[model samples]
Target: MSPILLTVNAGKSAAVARTDAPSGLTGIDKRPVDGEVAVSAPGPRGVGGSGLAGDSIADLRHHGGDDQAVYTYAREDLDHWAAELGHPLENGVFGENLTTEGIDVNDTRVGERWRVGDELLLEATSPRIPCATFADWIGERRWVKRFAEAARPGAYFRVLRPGTIRAGDRIEVVHRPTHEVSVAFAFRAQLGERSLRPRVLAAGPALHSELYRNATAWAENA
Candidate 1:
């Protein structure tokens, strides 16, 4: 895998278009190929425009973030997006903030870690469940919900350190913690009865504070 493929988007216009008000078929691949994706820092379009500025978004976690945003590939579905929009991924349909080459975003479980450039450290946090915003883009209210049921979720991050991310940057796997609990596992656990929740509770407070908060709750409930 190529490690990372950082991309910058064109602001809300691009974001909403993909998720809600799609522009119909545009390119040859079939789906919405490309519109905009944003860098952690602003781009030529600027922060409000689409790009981030001077590590501003990274700085949002000066204290710590409960979740981080990361994307991965699920080519089959992507092909649907491509085919529907007549734009291929090669055409940049996702407007993904970053299009990773090496790692599958879905594979990024909570507690996972990676190194970007020299300074910033990216770690998987809670998986991003579908939201209304996503539904707005796809034009189907259930698409977001369906995504959660189908793919489970994508990794979000809590920045361990802040720095710039660029296209083709080397994303090094620094660590993958040994744990019985992962975000997806947790959600699956929630599907029926109490199974993995107890395990998460048992892990104790050694994990990131954010996780521990959920763990603490699960422990109590379990």
Candidate 2:
């Protein structure tokens, strides 16, 4: 089935937080919303204007900005988690701006671009690296380790074209780079397997700028 946006989500404030949140503040508790939302390039913190129009990033040091402008998660993966956790996994619960259906988000390669609705163009940049904030948000024991081990971390994107995005908007793959650095591969390489670091180089400069910098730094030090 063709991938479609299952939900459009955003947050107006950083109210979604735990008293003991690792980062001290977190915007990971996004909720779904109705109507159309604008999608655009990085704004103050590299956040897109789409469904993430007012989304806030608590830990600017690590999350949000250009390469991490928008996050997309798959309903299929959410379903898996729902089954595993024995509870319902709602859209945007993971702080993603786009909850997509029928997309192999984990398998999508870095640099692949998707056109949403008429004007939004987003390019996959990197896989989310679970953090203490995420673990605390889910209230699951060892959630970070479990999520990393699963290797199904969803993808982050950089907005290429600005436009409105709403639920049921169609997604079309407009560009797919000739690289093997899928989101899952990149996630495993960075978090689980150091040997795969070299593989990330195959993605070239199209790899997320931050990830590219990290890989370059690793290479320089190695």
Candidate 3:
């Protein structure tokens, strides 16, 4: 199967659930949309949220920004989790803006650039760091620990070119940086694998600002 977008998901509204979240609400209940959805950079974190026009992100401090304008997860990963958990998982259930097929999202290089549809250009920036809200939303025991241990946190992208995206859009990798820092490796580093910090820092400017800063500070102190 060729790499393509399986679904475009956006939160319908913020729900007053997820006590683990700072806002006492969660926008993780994203649902598949029928038609085209506009995509663009949503500025900086804490102020901007979700690149998809109608999407809502309740936790602004941790999610959404120019670096995390879009979040993507693979249907394959979802399938793996579904079988492991003895239940079926729906698209967008993980709060990903895009659910992809036939792509190794976790293995993607941190600086890779993907062209979605015709004009939506997205640059891979970082991996989703499972949070308390995500754990609460999943409603599984030790979900955060399990997710982090699995080390397949999926990929987050920064929108470089704004355009409309819908289900079935083709995804083409137009560019990949020379660094070996991949989404999985970055996630491992984020999870306290100090040995991988230097390699993650090698991604340099292509890395998300926060990750880069953390890596830089670690390297300096080490």
Regions of model 3 farther than 4 Å from truth:
none
lDDT tens digits, residues 1-222, model 3? Answer: 889999999995565656455658888889999999999999999899999999998778877889999999999999999998999999999999999999999999988999999999999999999987788889999999999999889999999899998999999999988878999999999899988886788888888999999889878877
Report the number of the highest-TM-score candidate. Answer: 3
- State each model's CA lDDT, in order: 0.47, 0.83, 0.91
Ranking by TM-score: 3, 2, 1
Which candidate order results from sorting by lDDT in descending order?
3, 2, 1
Question: What lDDT tens digits, residue by residue, belong to model 1 across residues 59-125?
Answer: 2222113343333343444555566556554422332334455556665556777786666576765
Badly placed stretches (over 4 Å) of model 1 are 6-66, 69-96, 190-194, 201-211
TM-score of predicted structure 2: 0.91
What's model 1's overall lDDT?
Answer: 0.47
Would you list the clashing residue pairs of candidate 3? none
- Where is model 2 poorest over a 10-residue stretch in terms of lDDT? 43-52
Q: Give the C-alpha lDDT of model 3.
A: 0.91
lDDT of 3 at 6: 98
Residue lDDT tens for model 2, 138-191:
999889889999999999998877788899999999999887899999999899
Better structure of 1 and 3 per TM-score:
3
Tell me the lDDT of candidate 2.
Answer: 0.83
Identify the superior model by TM-score, candidate 2 or candidate 3. Answer: 3
Give the CA lDDT, 0 to 100, for residue 61 in model 1.
22
RMSD of 2: 2.4
